[model samples]
Target: ARNGFVVNGALLLDHDEDKLANVLPRPNAVTNRPWAVLGVLNGDYPRLHICDRTVTFGRSPDCVVQLDDVHISHKHCTIERDGNNGSALVVNHSSNGTYVNSRRIEGTATLSEGDDVVLLFDRIDGAMHGKALLGQQRVVDGRGYPVLVGYRVISVNLLA
Candidate 1:
């Protein structure tokens, strides 16, 4: 909470680090913690959790986070915590490709606290990254566009 500013959906990195934009959110008490997002594509995880073990995302049922949409490959990618630090890495190899902070990854990408992981990708004339609620479209902005309808989470007080 007393770290960075919570802009769109996640934390904002540019604000003064000495002052907090808001308070931290209390956990929902669910095993599903942070980083298990992409909820809009398949109603899976608007909110995600990054346990010690590696979590997989794809169209297959075996994936920890399975997305049913055809755009997703049978076995797309994996998100594992990068040590005890509050950071992660995404390994992607989907047919349609996975987006990290709105940029397509060649093979892998490092994920920070405020980064976004997008599964359903369309034509990206140009793109911008912003925090989004679950994975819903209108849910969040698309590449080259501003999507403005989501329940952004800054803290318990900022949840819409």
Candidate 2:
């Protein structure tokens, strides 16, 4: 099975593949893991990978970012725990503008359901999903298993 997940419409994958037939998440009657919201940039295989608690974006092999575990390239973005709200992932806009719901989000913003998050990297747009937001993207090399990113909305129950 592939090791990865989706968040805010961004399809996070584990490997670099042009075409993956088993990228989407499979339906589980038991565990009932929350579904991730995903968005894709323009390309045959445009997906991010979540491995070892880090998120690797794009296929260039150099586009990688650390989410909650180890720090990779600080040039991308920062996902930190909200001091005021323990249930939200506070996305800080770096040199590249971090967009939420197609709007450029400055400073720190709380993410809710249905929110679209686009990490500004040229022309690529990364969308967000929750009960409040719902976006979809094709995931590659997912092994038909859900890629679970710990960054989840605290206010909304995505599974419910």
Candidate 3:
């Protein structure tokens, strides 16, 4: 008996690739372990990698990704690897707040590849400030703040 299948007239043998075919992993998602890339607004800052299961980003010196921004709280947010499937959980733990794709994160949020992860901060005037994704400039009030937006930090081709 043949232990294989065919799709679109292509033969798929029961090899290493076939064994893992059923499992659909995101193109850029981590396969064995969960990982993340933290890039500051624009290309001013270097791209930081999150290899550990747990990572903390805040103004505190002890934080894994420390920021000197006054708007950032000492203990801002944490990114935890949810499972071996490469999905991560981002938990907000600061007054400044956290946002994912322009929406405020109530408590925790699941992070995927290419998701827009925004870190918010409250200005003295009560206005909000935060780092957005690259390219997509955010419109703050009347004036169009050509701030950096979108995830153009890392090249997508490398992941594929």
Q: Top model by TM-score, which number?
A: 3
Q: Give the TM-scores of the predictions, in the order they appear.
A: 0.52, 0.36, 0.55
Model 1, 9-120: lDDT tens per residue? 3433332322221322223222334433322321222343233336666767666555555666888887655555534577886766777656778887876544556766
Q: Highest lDDT among the candidates is held by which one?
A: 3
Tens-place lDDT digits, model 3, residues 6-121 = 22223344342432333322343444432566544333333444446666666675665555566667877877666646466788898767766566688998866555555642
Global lDDT of each candidate: 0.45, 0.35, 0.49
Query: Cα RMSD (Å) per model?
Result: 12.4, 12.5, 16.0
Which lDDT tens digits does candidate 2 get at residues 54-156? 2333223333433322221244444332334333353543554555545557776766754545553221234332222113443211122112222222233
Local error of candidate 1 at residue 39 (angstroms): 7.4
* Candidate 2 segments whose C-alpha is farther than 4 A from its true place: 1-73, 121-160
| TM-score of structure candidate 2 | 0.36
Better of 1 and 2 by TM-score: 1
